[model samples]
Each structure stands twice: as C-alpha cells, then as structure tokens.
Target: MPRKGMRSLFFSPKVSTSTDSSTSSSISYFPSPSRFGFSPSKPSFSESVMNRTLEMAEPIIMKWNPETTTFAKVTSLFYDNRKEAIVFIKWVKNLQKAMQLFITGNSSSEKLVRAQNLMQIAMKRLQKEFYQILSMNRAHLDPESVSTRSSSTSFLSSISDYGEEDDDEDTRIVNESITEVEDASSIAMADLKLIADCMISCGYAKECLKIYTIIRKSIVDEGIYKLGVEKFSASQVHKMDWNALELRINHWLNAVRTAVKTLFNGERILSDHVFASSDSIRESCFTVITKEGAIILFGFPENVAKNSKKSPEKVFRILDMYTGISNHWPEIDSIFSFDSTTNIKSQALTSLVRLGEYVRTALNAFESEIQKDSSKLHVAGAEIHILTTDVMNYLSILSDYSNILSDILADSPPPANNSVTESYFGFTDSDDSPAPPITRKIAWLILVLLCKLDAKARYYKDVSFSYLFLANNLQYVVEKVRTSNLKYLLGDEWLSKHDSKVQQFATNYERLGWSHVTNTLPEDPTAVRTPEQVKEIFKKFNSSFDQAYRKQSVCVVLDSKLRDAIKVRLARKIFRGYQKFYNAHGVAMQRDRNSAAVVRFAPEDVGHRLSDLFFGTVDSGSGSHSSFDPSSSHSRRP
Candidate 1:
C-alpha cells in the first residue's frame, strides 16, 4: 500500500503508458522501497514510493543522450512524442522530490546519488535538444520569420499571390515551398518556446539563454552588416570628402529604416515570445542582441554631425539622417523601451540633437561665407554674381528640406541687424505677421546677400550699371524663390515685396543707364529755336545718345522678362523724349545745308537701336569689352 502523496507523486502521461523498460525497472525497485519501511501501512510509505518512482523513471530519462543521438537527426521531441517528453519532465520533478526526501530522512544512499546523476543526464539531453533546434532551424527561426508567426497564413498567402502574378510553374512550386517553410517556421517557434519553458523550469535557463542569445546576436549583427552599417569613428567620418560622406549617408538612410522596422523590431518580438516564461530573460536577451549594434547604427549620424566638415550643402544629408530617425521614432521607442536598452534610445536622441546642431552650424557658416566674400572681381556685364548663384542655389535646395529645418530652427532667431531686417529693400518684416524661423532665417540670409550685392555693385564705376547689377542679381534671387520649394515657404507676400524692389532697381537703371541722352533735350519739345541754336542742340543730342548707346549696348540683362521691361521703359523715356525734340528741331536743321552731319540719327533708327542694347556685347558684336568705366561721377545708390 502507498501513501496518498506518494500515489499522487507518481509520473503519469495522458497520451501513452510507460514503456516496457520503465515497467521492468519498477519491478526491480519494489523490494528496495520495502527495505526503507518497517511495515506495509507505515507512515513513511510516501517517501519510500517516491524513491521507487525515481528508479522506475531512470530508463526513459537516460534513453536519449546528447552524445549519441542528436535532436537534429530525430524529429522534435515535443512533436514526435509529446507524452514521453511530458513524462520525462515529470521524472525530473520527481527526482528533485526524491532528493529532498532522502536528505530530510538523513539517508543519502545509492538511490540519492543515482537520482542526482539522472537529473544531470536529463538536463544535458534537454540542453542539447534546445541548441540543436535553434541551430538546425536557424533560417526558419530567423527574427523576421518569428516576428511574422502571428500572421503566417496571411503572409504566406501574400507570397503565393505574388508568385501567381507570374503564372509560371517554377513560381508555383516556389510559392508552395515557401508555404511549407512558413509552416515549418511556425512549428520551430513553438518548439523553441517549449524547450525554453522546460529548461527554465528545471533551473537550467542560463545554458538555454546562453545558446539563444549567442546565435540570435550573431544574426542581428549580420543583419546590420548586410544592411551596410559599419562601426565608424568620428575621425574616419571627418576625413571623408563630401561626395564620399554623402554616399555613406545615403546607405545609412536605407539601412536605418530596415534595421529599425525589421531587424531590432523582429528581435524584440522573437525574444519576448521565446522567453515568454520570464520577463527578465526576454528583456535581457533582446538587450544583449540589439544594444551594441543599435548604438553603433544610431551613433553614425551623431559621428557625422559631430566630426564631418561643416558646409551649407552637407546640411541636407544630415537632415535626411535626422528624418530617418524621426520617421521611425515610434517603432524605435517601442522596440528599445527596455530599461536595459535605454542607452540605445538615448544615443538616437543624442544623434538628433547633434545633427540639429551641425545643421545650424553649417547654415551660420554659409551666411558667414556670403558676408566674407570680398573678391573685388566685378562680374562681367553686371550679370548675376557667382555669390548670388551659389547662395540662391544652396538656399533653394535647403528649402526642399524646409519641414526638417523648421523643427531644427524652431528656436533659432532671425538676423537682428536692422539693415537686413526691414530697411533699404523694404522686406516684409512686420512683427504682426510673424514668419516661422526657417522663413525668417531664409529671408535674413537673402537680405545678407542683398546687402553684399549692394557692396559688389559699388565696384561698377557707372551708377547705371550699379542699378542694373542690383536688378539682375535681385531678379535671379526672386526667380529662384518663386520656382523652388521656397515659393511656399517665403510666401507670395515675400515675393511681392521683392518684385517691387526689382522694379525699383529697373526704374533706377532706366533713369541712369541713358541719363546722358535724356537730359540733353529741352523740357518743352516744341520750343522755337534759331538755325544755329537748333543745330547746336542736335549736335549735343547726337553726342549724348551715341555715348549712351555704346555704353548700354555691352551691359547684360539675362532674364528675358526683366530685359524686355527695361528695354520698353528706356524706349519710352529716351526714344519718345528724343523724338519730340528731334521733330521740333529737324525742320529748322533740314533748311540748313549742314543737316546731314548735325542730325546723324533719326527717331526710327534710335528706336531700332534700343532693341540691341541689353543683349550682351558678345551677341551685339560691340567689341570684346563686357563693361567699361565712364568718367562721369554718379552716386552708387542709383
């Protein structure tokens, strides 16, 4: 007779009875149990029955040694004979109970030592099985596959559907094969969880976690490498040229997305599922696998921001990196939420801060470069300056990243100087309709350039060319703003204000470009004159108009619209003004015999010559000189 506790302690399998070998061992251990008890109905009978139970379970426990038959060759233990595996786990528990009973009774015998040895054998077999399952099913148990376990059917169906689009036999077979692999992946996941649960329950979790984390960590590291992520130091990044750095940035942009969305996220999910038995293990395993690689991955941007040489053009790439992190911040936070992995989160955030700082530094340097451009090299034809072209092109490309710049420049104040703020050009700098930082920042940069252009225009000796210089450069700036993403950022109000300035510059150029010609004629065109007076007036007009045409012909106005408008204004003022005076004087001059020498050009010839004025000297065949210095002194402000 057995005690109730002893009867309850015996290992039982719902699916199958004990094997024949286990039965024979039970018979062999029957007499040994009675030797421990004084009578059949003894109070210590439960302890005796437990001792017998361990001995009977020995054959099943040691049946599959890791050294002889590996789990890779055989089917999964839980899948092949779950009942036997369950019985084996029960035997492990019973062995612990038997060891405790022997120690309590102060009877450490051969049975106790045997139970201890059998326990070690069971653990070794389970550890081997765990490692084999993980290793053999590496591809199937990949983090991506494990992550999709919850949606395996839909994922497989999508694969099948994609393959069906080709309508080929090979595709069909490949789809079926993928479906089978997905099925196997599901089984593999369940099997990993089962083995994990068993080893952890038996106090062998260290061995299990060791194997799991090592394999999984290598997979994650490989994933990062394959994505083109590398451990880059600040110095290494600093030494690279902009073009080379730009390529690395692009690679990081692609790699970071896949790393966050798939690699770390999948690892997080897989770790949590595999170690569902323990929260600490889940977090530990995930942290071990992803922390180092994630920090390096995120730290690349920080290194670039900190170490790379600052340039206005380099800001766009930094913004791209910032956007990559910003776009996936939610996933990154969720995946790396564990306290153990908080450094990864902190590193990512630090990269954002560093990138923002770098962008601002580069922008300030750009403004400084514009301000420091002291080259006295006057641009030929008073056309768009190189500074204007480079600055506007930089700003236009910068405008494309306005959304990110807005965030980075949120706290950055506009230029404080009153000259660039609202004076001179009448930039719309009202406090009431406050612009965003990026808009104000861009406006300030333009104003700085405008101020710089004002200085550059002074290099021209002729005040008319100075005004033309301002008009040409300003027109180019306005066009850049209108065509690019800057159009939306600067707004129509900003464009309108600048357009008026351009018109003002044009008016000044029209007034000054041919001032000599206009001022030569009388105010009242129909005034009477003697033949001598009329011929003298005609001689002065011819001299002034010829000088003006020769000088203005070589000057360039690149914009067709601006060029036409200037020509029209000059035609109205100079052509019409001279025509009235010429009409008044021609009859008197024609009566004189010296009319042909005096009245050298008619009004129609003057009008036709105005057409050739603004097309540059190169086009007009007016000598190779693009610009000339006039002796007449005029204020540079024009």
Candidate 2:
C-alpha cells in the first residue's frame, strides 16, 4: 500500500524494477532527520498538540526582526538555491513528524494524504510509507531520545534572532549597516531666513508667513511628514486647511490643573472664577479669521476686541456671565449672608442634609473623642439641627437673588467649566438648549428628594444590616435640595421660560453680581397663595425635610405650619422658598430612591436671608409661621 511519491525528497532515486519485497513492505516511508523539531507525547490529543504548538509558536512568529543582516543575506541564497533548500526543508519536516508519531506510539488507523513533499526529487507518493515508518520507530522515538536531540543540537541558533525581544536582549551589537528607519526631513533656521528674505524680495511676505504656519501645525502632528514622501516645492506652507473659528476652548489640561488646585485649596474662586475667566477669554476673543495663512494671535476678537461692538453669542456664552459675576460680587455677598441665630423651622431639604452629613462624617472619624466629650455628645443633634436649618435657609432663599441665574439655567442651559458653575448653570439654548430654570432645577431636586424620602418611608421599612446606615446619609439629603423637581409642580412655561430675566441674569450673574437680583423684583413674581390651599405642598416639603433629619440620625422635627402648607395652588405657582419642594415631590409627586433632599445642613447663627434663600413654604394668608400648630390644626402664626 506504498504511495507513488513516497520518500521523494530523502531517497536519491526510485527503483526502476518494482518487486514483491517492496510491495510486501507496504511502503516503509522512513523519513530522514528533520531540521524543524517535533516530539509527540504518548497518544496525546491532536487538538491539544496543534493548540499548544500554535500558542507557543505564534508569539515567536509575530515578533519583528527588521535589523537581521543574516535574514537579508539568506534571502538571496534562498532565491538562488531554491530547489536544494526546498528539498532539505521537506526532509527535515518529514523526519521530525515521523519521529513525533513514533514517540506517541499511535498506530495510524485513519486515511491520510501522502507525506511526500517534493515532486522534483523522487517520483514516489507516501501515505502507506509514512504509516510503515510510524510503525517502525514507535519505540525508538521516545521522550528520552527526543530530549537528547533537543539538548545536543543547536537547531535554532542558525536562524537570525534580531527582533525587539531577542536581538536587544541577548546581543549588545548595534550594527550601523543594518538600518531600520530612513532619515527625517530637516529645514534649517538659516534656510528659513533665506526663504523669508527671498519671499519678501518676490512681494509674497504674507504668503511666506502663511507657509510658515502650515509647516508649524502639520509638523506638530505628523512630525515633518517624512522628508522622502513629498517635494517641498513651496516649503510645506502654502497647502493649508484649518477648522472654522468658534470661541470654544477645549483646554482640558489647563482645566484639569485648575480643578486640582481647587480640590486642594477648597476655594470657591477655583470653581467659579477659573471657569468664568477661561470661558470669558474664549468668548470675548472672537475675531474673524480673515486671512487663513498664518494665525495672527494679536488680532483676536476682530470686532469685540478691537472696538466696542460685541457678539450677542459672546455675551450669552461668556462675557455676560463672567463679567457680571466678577463685577457684581457684592450682590451674591449680600444674598448669601447666613443668620447663625435663626433656625429654619422650614428647611431647604438637600442643603440642610449635606451639612449634617459632613458634620456626622467628621464626628464619626473621631467617634471615640466625640463620645467622651459630654458637651460634644449632647450638642451633636442640636448642632446638626442648627447647621441643617442654616443650610436649608441659605439654599431655599438662593433663588430670590439668583433669579437671573435661575433663568439662565432654565431657559438656556450651557456647559459649565468648574464646580460652582456646573452646580448652578443649567443647560440652555444660550449654552446648549434652555436649561431648566434654577428654580425648576431646585424643584427637580426637591422632587427627587421627596421620591427618595418616599422610597425610604414606603419601601425600606425592615431594618437589617444593610439598612442600618440608611439613618445617616446626609449627602442624599443635600442631593434632594440640589435636584428638586420644580418643573412638574410649577407649569414649565412659568418656571422655565427661555426668555426669562432670571435665566438672563443667571447667564450673566457672575459678571453682574448678586445685587442686581436682590434689589430687583421678579418681572412676574408668583401670585400669593392662600394658606387653606396647597396643603399638600407643605406636606411634601415637610416629609422630605423629615427624611433629611432622619438621614442625619437625629430626631425628626415635625413643625405645624410647615406640614400644613401642602396644597394645589402653590404647586401651580411654585414659590422660591421651602414650600416648593413640599408641593411637588413628597406625596402626590413621583419618588426616586436616589433623589436629593430639598434642604441642606448648616449650623444655627449661620447668616441667611429669605430674600437670599428661596424654595420653601410661605403662608401668604397667615403672613407668618408662628401661629401654626405642630400636630392637627395647621395654622400659620402671624
């Protein structure tokens, strides 16, 4: 059963006269010794064999070795003596394969293609012969023999190992003749000077400058564009194409640096001033890129910079915002004044909560010290309440003086550069699309807070190991105040007007300052509501605030007037005070588990103004909260 082309490469010639001995032998295809080594294990799985070989060899093959003088030299030799090399290579392949089959001792049981490699050498085939060879050396091709051959022969040494891993590691020879890369393009300063002089002589000074810019930008990106690839007919300059001008600065690196500084300094300037100033620079420096040759850094903001005319987009985008904030710092100063003595009987849910959490976390860090100090232990809840009240009041009234900001946030939402701006700025058409107004933003915060409280009150009843920490999550409370859903309760048209003065002010608050808002009345202030109406409004804010207190791990404050103000009318004309949240998110409104609380935490004696803080329950009918009952009959004290 010997194949016709068997032993083609190894045997010198084929026997002219075919005999019975050869026929009885059934093709003894004993192969010659192979260069490429192979040693099969005992009847191993073919899949594993192929898998292991491929896994081991693929890595070696993928590695590049361009600096191999040996390979380059061998290429010529291979092409010249192609026949001899091919025959030798086949002989080596066959011998090792046979050796592997012999060692594995797996007698051939399946039909296979002939192992004969070269048609040019011997004119015989090889399927049966290969089987005979496998049978003949099954015992001799053992692990021991294979190991001896592997150790004795320097088989791989002849092949040049000049890749990154092999050449650089084993040998310290740096051959100059074997170059891997071509030389780079070089344009000297002297050449540039000569070119400039020549261009001036030719009455093309501007063209020369334009050419210089093209080279500068392109060189930065592709590194001189490989000297050999192109003809520098006009010197890498005249062929320029650039993006259109937009006052958008994506200086992420600088912004990141500013952020890091703020993080370490804990400064408001870093959060507010940094972004405002950078954005201002970007917007205010708008110049028509008239000539597209060289970028004239000096002539930016063609209209605005050189003269008095300004881009409305610039005002909306940067100038109005930053300059207004910068110049009107006193307004914010007056509005943000905190009253350390006053307790916010009515709270700004999210704001109050965060301060409480911060205090709690601070105390928890040194719980041993806190517990030991009798005064600290006694005043812990009191301090939290006072701080919570202060924070709530401040945040609640923020809407009053920041109407312009509220409008900016609601009507025209814009991208914020820093923390302070990000927190306050709403996405708007002036910025992106009109942002939900600041009041609405606060409303949304309140709604979310209400949802969270509702969820905690409604769903998380069973106290377990996981539920234990639910008692002290002040951050969650702050979130409610920060993200109150005011839009749903207050008509979107009223709360989030695109052309509202509030948004315009907000977009320009930083530049104009807080005084502009504190002194001015809302163009359309919410109509006063009767205490008898909107009872639901008071309830929601109350529940959400209660949740805030609960989050602080302190006893909840169930105020009378505060609870009774919840109703429908107030929901329609959402106020800037604490009642706004109470109406929208506590009971009738949808609740989200992760929603922020309406109020924030701050200690008593912290200065805050009703004019400064908004988004709370206001009893127009009763005029004051002193007349309210704590439990049943909801009445506001005059």
Models 1 onward score TM values of 0.78, 0.17
RMSD of 1: 9.2
- Model 2 C-alpha lDDT per residue in residues 486-516, reported as the tens digit of each score: 2232334433331242223222322222222
Residue-wise C-alpha lDDT for candidate 1, range 1-638, written one tens digit per residue: 24454655453423323667766565542354566766655336435655676767677776765555565246555556644654665556556656666656656666667777787888887776777777888898776776666554333322211211222543454445445654777656655675677677667889989999898899999998888889987778889888888888888999998898778878887777678779998999899989888988999999999888888777888889999998899999999999999899999999999999999999999999999997664555787888899899999999988889988999986556645556543456666655688988888789899999999898888888899999999999999999999898888877898899899999998887777778887788767456777777788888888887777777777776787788777777778887898777776676778675788777877776776666566332322323222332222111
Clashing pairs in 1: none
Segments in model 2 whose C-alpha atoms lie over 4 Å from true places? 1-198, 205-211, 219-408, 412-436, 459-638
Each model's total of backbone clashes? 0, 143
* Candidate 1 lowest-lDDT run of ten: 157-166
Report lDDT (CA) for all predictions. Answer: 0.75, 0.27
Q: What is the overall TM-score of model 1 with all chains considered together? A: 0.78
Q: After TM-score superposition, what is the CA distance of residue 249 in candidate 1 from its true location, in Å?
A: 3.6
Error of 1 at 63 (Å): 3.1
Task: Quote the lDDT for 384 in model 2.
Answer: 20
